[model samples]
Target: MSLQLPDVVETYFAISNGGDLSQLASCFCSDATVFDENKTHEGLAAIEAWQHEVRQAFDFEVEPLQALQEQGQLTVLTHLAGNFPGSPIRLNQVFRLEDDRIRSLEITPC
Candidate 1:
């Protein structure tokens, strides 16, 4: 979709797709929060744990299909496929960035 995403956001997708836990955690601010699966994970420790659990539970890949930005927030539409139910689904990832790091992210089904 030719999305010119911010560096941090691009790094997020890259690390996530590669299943690199350390690199994924590095893309976020220390106090970053991630909202997914109807739960909130706060701080780098929590975010890392959440990412680890999810990655271990499902082998998934996210492909960015579209993107939109407003103020300091960027929302990307992504196609996710994995071994879980609904092997392929569209999702919207809303991210808020600060100082080149992801401050917060909320992912929801599209």
Candidate 2:
């Protein structure tokens, strides 16, 4: 399937797959937030730490299967596959953007 995502959102997924920690900072604003796995990560430093923790825990790749935008929020249906338990799973990634950067992101089960 083909889908078009906002520039920042596209870059987020690209960076996620690339696993380049340095480039990950480019996907979000300085004070960005991420809500995932019942934990909240605030600020760029926290987010980077969260990403690093997850990378060490699960070596996975995310693919955006579909995207929906409304009311300033973009929710993308993403598929993850890797060596983690279940092997593959789908998640709903809700992103709020600001000035071409991701202001916040929340990942929920889909």
Q: Could you estimate the TM-score for every candidate?
A: 0.93, 0.93
For model 1, the run of ten residues with the poorest summed lDDT: 17-26
Candidate 2: list runs displaced more than 4 Å.
none
What C-alpha lDDT does candidate 1 achieve relative to the native structure? 0.89
Clashing pairs in 2: none
Q: Candidate 1 lDDT, tens digit per residue, 41-104?
A: 9999998888888888889889999998888688999999989998799999999988889999
Cα RMSDs, all models: 1.2, 1.1
lDDT of each: 0.89, 0.89
Superposed by TM-score, candidate 1 places the C-alpha of residue 57 at a distance from the truth, in angstroms, of 0.7
